[model samples]
Target chain A: MYVAAKGGEKAIRNAHALLAKRRRGNKNLPSISLAQIAQQLTLAVDRVMAEGSLYDVELAALAVKQARGDLIEAIFLIRAFRTTLPRFGYAQALDTSEMLVRRRVSATYKDLPGGQLLGPTFDYTHRLLDTSLGVADEAGEVDDEARQADPADAAPVAMPRVTDLLGQEGLIEAAPADEGAEPFDITRAPVSFPVDRSTRLQTLARGDEGYLLALGYSTQRGYARSHPFVGEIRFGDVEVIFEAPELGFELSLGTVQVTECQSVNQFKGSATTPPQFTRGYGLVFGQCERKALSMALVERALRWKELGEEPGAPAQDEEFVLSHCDNVQATGFVEHLKLPHYVDFQAELDLVRRMRAEQAAERPADGIKEAAE
Target chain B: MALMARAEAGELEAVLAGFAPLPAASDLKPPEVGLVMLRGRTGGDGAPFNLGEATVSRAAVRLEGGASGFAYRLGRDVKAARAAAILDALWQDEARRAEVDAALAPVRARLAAEAAQVRAETAATKVDFFTLVRGED
Candidate 1:
């Protein structure tokens, strides 16, 4: 049974007012602009974009600012905003092979085609805080001339994928042929069990980074261990193409930066198939390297049944992972505890009180007898 | 359309403003902001999968002279989307086509320069690994 409880509108309104003031901080300090967050706090923006499942840097930055830097809140804000906009249609599948390579590396190979480019990464940086960053930028500071490259030194336009090299020697399993059929849309339909690879990939792609990281770590700690090597990880921009009904031909819809990881896992030969290296793939919006790698590991671990491997780990259970992966859904259920539950609590209280009264009536003199004893 | 889509936030709008008395075009489809679900292949070459969605604004316009043009671009710049759609309609006419190209030339150049700059910076980081010779060798 449910009952209505009201009369907090004024308090709610004032709380919102207080929140706005708190979000602003000191009045003397200049407020952070959306541009600043979009450019400097780019990774934060990227995270909200990835998990929110909506790619718009400006909006993500806005959400970050509005949420007072609370990433989960920011993601919630982005998701709420997503419901207002209508879906135009699906775009053509992205071709990562045509990416304008910014950073490309392979852990399994020392030397690969097109060579490795480090780009701008914190991988080699010392963890010590740089006091220099605390100070405002000095105007007109120039970049090192020596760091600039000659046009002739540029990498080849298209770097061959690391998997392809292994594939040529029949060491790695070949990719299934492209059927050109439309993939399942998770956003449109409710997720059911026995989902296809497409649906699983979509869920993982939009899943929370921290959750995926923990699950991936579990796999590495010998829970359904699949000896995995990062075949390739690349981050860069790729053009998005959409086919509009009004426009008969496909049209380019600008570009988006994405990080992609391909994990090569060992698969012992099944009774019917030969022994070969299997694969796990991850692709996410913007330069989210860690998240992409984690997604790949978890994705591979989840494929145990398909690969004929014994499955017992938490990550291998698709239902658990998919159901709990979405932070928006997870936070909603967890946070709803804060809302008024007076009726439900009253019912429980009544039940408990009645049971206590009955117990006292049944043994009215037991308390005095126990005390005397 | 590609050049316009790649143009800076206000670049398209500024170019459109230059042609003060714009060629009157009817809205075949008014500018509307929406999402476009982006798809990706499982293994980069195999079965398809949904990656995510991107914000897109699209508009369709028909010029007075009976030419129709449409545009779809990333982000929520409604005015820029409409401006690109108008330019597309104008570009269908042979005489107005050159005018459109001349206006968008700077954007094309800027995009090219930006691409070149990234390519150069990336090139500088390209590693050439060499194995050391063992003393026995």
Candidate 2:
């Protein structure tokens, strides 16, 4: 006597309890620690940070452990936790030109300033999995190369931006001069249509990496057209400067590592702006070179209107791009179907059942009689 | 103010290294750690992306005289943060300004010493690489 009409509250509670128990998993097996997740599953933590839209490593690692390494679930958890916290203030835009670069390479130029130091990249590594990674050996763990400052090339206070060089040669349109206008804070308010440039960038930065990557890939398939070259990509630490109201001065809070990418795209002359190379840009926290590059491509793709060109591609659609970019939002709505939908289901069920009965009563022997006629 | 917090943050542990005179505070916000998404832009004005999360602790307090102060510091030091909020509130008062400065003197001395030590180490390792004059020149 299974009643489809009734709820599964008891079962649901039990399932949740079971989930908690299994998340901790077998007692005999060693339990994974938060620090280990932070250390070993660094990239996974990075994803959670990106999609979760919050940046605490410990908490993101904890979410990873808590969600049993389901990255989307962990991202959801971080987002849920993030909503409860208070925002202090916005940080000043970091100067990536002065980054203490750990890894820097330019596809456009070979012998650029700071030369190419390909620090800690997967580009050179073989794809084969090493079984030795399963075994934990503290001594065998690879350490990050200690950065040496060679006097032959001291890092310039301001590295010559590749785009700036193009601008100087009159090969590209000059960048918009700084108006010191504050960008809209999307976190504090609902995202409005025709959002400011900063708000748009903010949305794309934390957009689902996979989704953005696919969209960026689509551009290469001629969904959108852009002749893009990797002007520069850099990874490194940069100091954070915050202006304190109490002291009436600014101070360096500390440093955080970042990854940045710039894509130079071919452009023809528009009505107002001259024919110069357009720029696509991406910046992210941590070593996310691929994500940054994808973001840059997609960002440029979205900039068709600003460049006075028509935005006809799917990647170019602002509403479509922004709304579905957040992984947490996508997961929540889709996966909420797992929750009890008995009420809605019953409503549809009743309508179907009544319609079937009415049709049976109106017809003679069957639908066969009507068909024969 | 972020600058005040940075200036006081290093000294926070040291300033309250001893006893702190607690100003009357109703915690508008109690000491709590929250995740702040750090964003960076390519070439300063380029596209922005999340760098990662830093653990930040913050506290806000209003003194008896009604000056309100707030502090945000790196990491999960609750007591230090609470003390900083009170110091911020106290330092605002003309009468308490001198007292707050006196209390923070040790923190300043220690930080200055640390900076000097770093400078010395950096100078010790300094190497000047000069291009060799070409034989043609």
Candidate 3:
């Protein structure tokens, strides 16, 4: 029922050539630089970096440019490139308590510590597109007063987390002990059903933002809902420390920008426990507040069993959520349909044709005679 | 080392040029680009988890005088890593340590200025809350 056929080697090469030309839309227009994409299209770079699970800004920018601004394609490129490199070390767990605070806000409390600094967020901005941005000359204009420049002393030198405040009062659940046990590495090992919190968190950290967003949104719509509140959302840079084999002691490996979200969810006390606030954690590379927030929501939803809540929703199903969360794998399987499945399709076609012919033969002159009688 | 890693694209090379006839560094470990898994604690302060991986380039080099040094940074800059490794080797010599510091002074200044700017910008957004009084007040 199946036969092998191969042809289209030259066609594939020519198709790639056409694609390269199409990527550069106009012949006379100036080509975009990697620096420009890294600087100007920063959020795009951040998204690709987050989803790609690779923290190199320059490479993400290059991938974006080469993919012609297709983020998933860019992510695929980064994922492919990541496999070629050897993993040298594991960094000491990031201590975000010492983050050089850029944007810090808490929805649970209004006048909390660090006093809610809004650093370059588009939260309050009207969604309308400014026509000026379309014009090259007008786009360069800067309004000084719009920035609301103030003295340096206004922001406190020591910014603390809102969760720490609630944590102090024993309102929120405490952090688990630092048991020197090694967390399961999602990349190194194949993920199986019913993973630990560490694996689930890692999977969600690099999971497709759009997929997580939808799943998170579903939780809010009462599918295993956990009344969630933004305990704190902060975007800033933290120094990475690594103790490489060559260097025995811990050494600073520069800083990486990250967005961290901690969600406080309402929990009903179980028979053995007292009612208290629970937490959902999310941390991702670069300043990806939206993705971080969505990750937090879904993270809380996924903890249904551990928290003693009934788990029937799709978000609550660890195997279902984790298995389909990775966009690269999802896209690959979905897009593979485009590839030549001639043998597979031909088998189905032949089966259908033979079945129809057999039915016609079986239907015989007796059927016509019976109908006439 | 932080200053060297944080320097601009060509700043390390520019600073290295100052010491024209520098001691050659032999590669103990040639510059290699690789990934370093960046781990994070749950709830921002809990049990550790693998958040993601960052691109890290590392190199180890030994000076002619037997001083070995290493460099690691969170990007794909092999040249920078090698230059930093060489600087590390040079700085191990107490006599040349001051020289390395003096060369990297500009980078220190630049980093300080950038931090101050971020501080000022972030400070501007800090909410200055005022309490609202009742009608009797």
Each model's fraction of native contacts:
0.86, 0.17, 0.75
* Candidate 1 lDDT tens digits, A123-188: 887888767667865522548467768988873566888988989988888776778878888889
Model 2 residue runs over 4 Å out of place are A1-10, A136-158, A245-247, A355-366, A369-373, B1-43, B46-55, B59-71, B80-137
Better of 1 and 2 by DockQ: 1
Query: Weakest 10 consecutive residues, lDDT, candidate 3 chain A?
Result: A147-156
Error of 1 at A129 (Å): 0.8
Listed models, DockQ each: 0.76, 0.16, 0.65
Mark the 10 consecutive residues where model 2 chain B has the least summed lDDT: B118-127
- lDDT of every model, 2 decimals: 0.89, 0.71, 0.87
lDDT of 2: 0.71
- TM-score per candidate for chain A alone: 0.95, 0.88, 0.94
* Candidate with better DockQ, 2 vs 3: 3
Each candidate's interface RMSD (Å, one decimal) is: 1.2, 6.5, 1.9
Residue A246 of candidate 3: its Cα lDDT?
Answer: 64
Model 3: residue B95 alpha-carbon error in angstroms = 1.6
Backbone steric clashes in candidate 3, count:
0
Candidate with maximal DockQ: 1
**Estimated TM-score per prediction?**
0.94, 0.77, 0.94
Candidate 1 segments exceeding 4 Å error? A1-4, A137-144, A359-373, B17-20, B129-137
Local error of candidate 2 at residue B7 (angstroms):
12
